[model samples]
Target: MDKHHKINIEYAKKLGLKSALVYQYVKDMNSDTKLHTIIEEFPYLSNEDVGNSIKSLVEQGLIEFNDDNQIITLSSTIQKTKIRTPISNRSNKIDKSWSPSEDAVEVLQRAGVDAEFIDGLLDEFIIYWSERSSTLVSYNSKFIEYCRLKWAQHTAEIDTKSVPRIIDKNWAPSEDCLDIIKMTGIDDAFVRLHLPEFILYWKEDGRAFVSWDIKFLDFIKNKWNYNVEVTSKEHTYKFDLFDPYADDEDKSKKSTKGNIKDLRKKYKI
Candidate 1:
């Protein structure tokens, strides 16, 4: 394996996830591998085992899954990926910069005070401090709507965007609480019906929420040709917007598609 791959696998192992997850997520471009594909790629793990691992990593905040994109992805960017070089090659070493916080700790250390806490102060700690100080939060509604859709590119699991978050000090879901998703099935239904406008939003109080337009639900229900329920076995996500040109009655009253009516010389098809 290349040195980068070796580093990625080591990181993945630290989080109890498959090394392939690190490979897929750590590369520069966006990814589209679904959870099923991930499980399939790592043949040794069973579905249940993979599912458990997902729960664990999501809780750890090391990775998140875009249901719409179908990939387990890394969120932490602190660790640098190392590239391999020739055996005889020598490279200059980069030095870590000193910040005010580091300076304070160093002064304390010189005075014989405890400065060890600074060792745990990483760039991520600053992220936490910013969130806490400003009461800002990542409301899932935005992620569910944009990030998930762009990544998954599928309509069915697109509702996974609505999957309620366990955003907290520990991000894992409680057993019965998670089962609520499985038994209720309504959120999943809404995801399927109105995915075009699903949104994840954060409130002013540092809480995140997800929502979509209900009028869209009414519009689709009134316009849909078939008997479609959330769990309906015959449902499809295809919309009629892209069909061959058909004249609308109101528009045709003011205009015409055939040669005779008006302004034909001024227009081109």
Candidate 2:
């Protein structure tokens, strides 16, 4: 006698042929089977392909892994009738109140994603897809992909910021940072005027920071706001280069006053 495996054609179409094959194998075994044993059964497929198939099955809620991740079994949600029937292809626009399924959340949590982080992205994700004209058969799968991509990017940014280093003389604000500053209506010349001072101040302080771009942005915003406030208050004060009555202390403050004067004359801010 020979054993027969029932492969779900719909699953094969949705999740590659390999995934459907692996799901059927797990269904038939009905026992906690080692991952390596399954891989050995499929000699024609590469280990990477086999691994991806198993991951796909797990992500789709058709299969699950034991705590150790060495054993695989069918999920409790799996049904024999459901496997035999083709999945419905009826697609509709995502609802404004749509949320990811529990299975999707569990898969992400199993992959070590933080629950709080996942919650934080829900609104942005919902708004983004709700505005689109597209529809999906399985939002859970899409949400899983979205969450994984975002988590990867978030981790990359954290890794970049964690390693603190001294600011080099050659460093300057990135184009993206400059673009954001420009969008706020800050003058390019004003930014240039403060660039050297900003760099010198940090260099002299000898304090390493996670992000100089952020520090520069804060510095520029504060200085620009202060300049605007001072200019508005002293709209009538005129700086005289050679005032006989001007004291040395007042002359020392004249540099800042002069810059503001120049800013008013040039930008009319």
Q: Where in model 1 is the C-alpha error above 4 Å?
A: 1-9, 17-30, 68-71, 76-269
* Worst lDDT 10-window in candidate 1: 79-88
31-109, model 2: which lDDT tens digit per residue?
8766655654554455556666876777677787653335677886433333321112344567878777676789789
lDDT of 1 by residue, 1-269 (tens): 01122335565567645633544443433543345444433434444455556655555565565543234556543221221111112321111331233333443345333334334443434444344423211112111222222222222224446653322432322232222222222233443444333222112234442322222233333433233353464334354445444556657755555444345555632
- Candidate 2: C-alpha RMSD to true structure equals 21.4
Question: Which whole-number lDDT from 0 to 100 does residue 177 have in model 2?
Answer: 59
Model 1 / residue 44 / CA error / Å:
1.4
Alpha-carbon shift of residue 90 in model 1 (angstroms):
55
